[model samples]
Target: MPTTRSALMVAATAAMLAGCAKPPEAPPPSSSAYRVYVTNEASGDMSVIDSATMNVIATVPLGKRPRGIHASPDGKTIYVALSGSPIAGPGMDESTLPPPDKSADGIGVFDVKQNKLVRVIHSGSDPENFDISKDGKRLYVSNEDVAGVSVLDLEHEKVIATLQTGEEPEGVRISPDGRWVFVTSEDAGTIAVVDTAANKVVNSFKVGRRPRSIAFLPDSATAWVNAENDGTVVLVDAVKHTVVDTVQLGERGVVKPMAVLLSPDASTLYVSTGRGKKVFILDVATRKVQASIEVGQRPWGIALSPDGKTLYSANGPSNDISVVDLATRQVSQKVKLTGSPWGVITLEQ
Candidate 1:
């Protein structure tokens, strides 16, 4: 009944409208083969590797500064902390740096099976790191610039609360019992402990200079925090929230601890020494360094193998992953990558 020109115009308008419509909720990740996901901060991409073959499978492009990464309980999805903040350190003037890209500041959720980023949830501002609750319903994210912890409701995709923390919060972890959450403040040189049940900062204690990373034992009764500037790893009593012991990794300027991981049997703690070009293996009970293996240049993010036989570390400067054999306590292989890998996490079959 209408002219063809008018009908085509209407069809074009409808198509445009549909394109502008909001996207629907994404489905959960499906079952996939076991693989290791490495976040490359400099390249803004994630490198997927075949664990069995120790070969890189694919490179998934993400947003800027994909630093912290964690796998969901079911291993169906992986969350990445993508920030827009300008990187600053002890002596740098932050005012001279460019403004943060607000649009890129969010938590990127990658579907395991699809091997792609399906959603990006707002995480307040400059979420450098985060820890998910045991039930996978909440995220305690560290907002570096604002010095606050943003608690977001995972299912609803909304922030329910914001808890104050020390200046420049970075490292974040949840207790195994799910009773407490710990965030390390680099500038404050302290650990802010949040009582999840009360939804408040229950305690705060200084460990040493520049606490960057943390790891908990299997029982979660104790925690190890790496004091970067001090080049030491301090043990903390989780329940009491107090420093119990300290194990020095290397000389102050030579050995900077960036990441720590616990053995499955809880007998040892593997530490990645930034700029030290090595990973320190410490005996847990004795609190002493048993051995140190040369990895690569500035090994930052580290992860344990499923079978507890090998260790993987993301070496930033070298742009590769150092694979260490636990039994041999040495680096067995180095998987080459093109980007500056910052964080590493593994998903199993």
Candidate 2:
């Protein structure tokens, strides 16, 4: 037996040693159930997919030329952009306008719980793409033909304001903090950063030719803009509001690129080549093309699952969505849909 002082010292040392030891290890990651929604522009319908089973659960009819799509933050509602007059945009002859389609030029609000379109809120002329604010109270709709961004009040279900932007704006994305909205001008080859609170274009930066879509990195410190005309992806620094670098994807003679999506981990970026029929997987840190997987004819719209394990590419001419497994970087499944698929969104329970 040790003396009282010696025993106390031993106990103190043991306590300190125990406190310095590492904690037990954490469990490995696992998969979770997810749902994928694809908007078929040709079919005028939406395809619902069970991500776990990789099967189509149901197909719901939507408005004409349904292109841009987004799910509510709480996953309660899915807003689909509907263009009644498909040929209303710039450079189009007014005489060519198809008989007015009542369902066009508005947002089809689908109640996710009910699995149906609950309401149609008129946004403006030719709503192409849209983004929801961080607080989920407002929606920014990029009306391509109208050359402006329409601010929709979700609670009021009405357009509160419309701010003029560049001609033929195609992509609209809200900043991570929901303070700014970035809209891409396909015809102008520029990006207009709008101040959400002020409802005005605050900054405009020149990017690659025909900038169509935009995606931000995980940190939101930088964003990437896909330039279809130049076949390059321009990286924009968020704080400085400038193009830091440009990554060329394909030769000008090859094909035009359409959409850009960043992996959930921010490790890789996926770009769909509209005329190339190939999806390019790029390493974010290295900015190198890691793999170029052949998808389908006229692959335009692209999306990734919430967990970042799967990728969905909408091939317009093929009229199907190619499901790519991120881990293996292979085409796991091809989900056939009605007409030309344009936009995709993933939902999780």
**Per-model TM-score versus the true fold:** 0.89, 0.86
Error of 2 at 166 (Å): 0.6
Clashing residue pairs for model 1: none
* Per-residue accuracy of model 1 over 199-293 as CA lDDT, tens digit each: 99988999999898888887888999999999999999988889999888889989999888888888889999988988999999999999999
- 183, model 2: CA deviation in Å? 0.3
Quantify all predictions' global Cα lDDT against the true fold.
0.90, 0.85
The sequence of per-residue lDDT tens digits that candidate 2 reaches over residues 34-132 is: 788998886788988887777777789987888899998899999999987654533568777667665567998998878888878999888989999
Give me the runs in candidate 1 sitting further than 4 Å from their true place. 1-33
The candidate scoring highest on lDDT is 1
| Residue 299 of model 2, lDDT score | 89
lDDT of 1 at 56: 82
lDDT of 2: 0.85
lDDT score, candidate 1, position 17? 94
Q: Which pairs clash in the backbone of model 2? A: 43-339, 84-104, 84-105
- Candidate 1 has a TM-score of 0.89
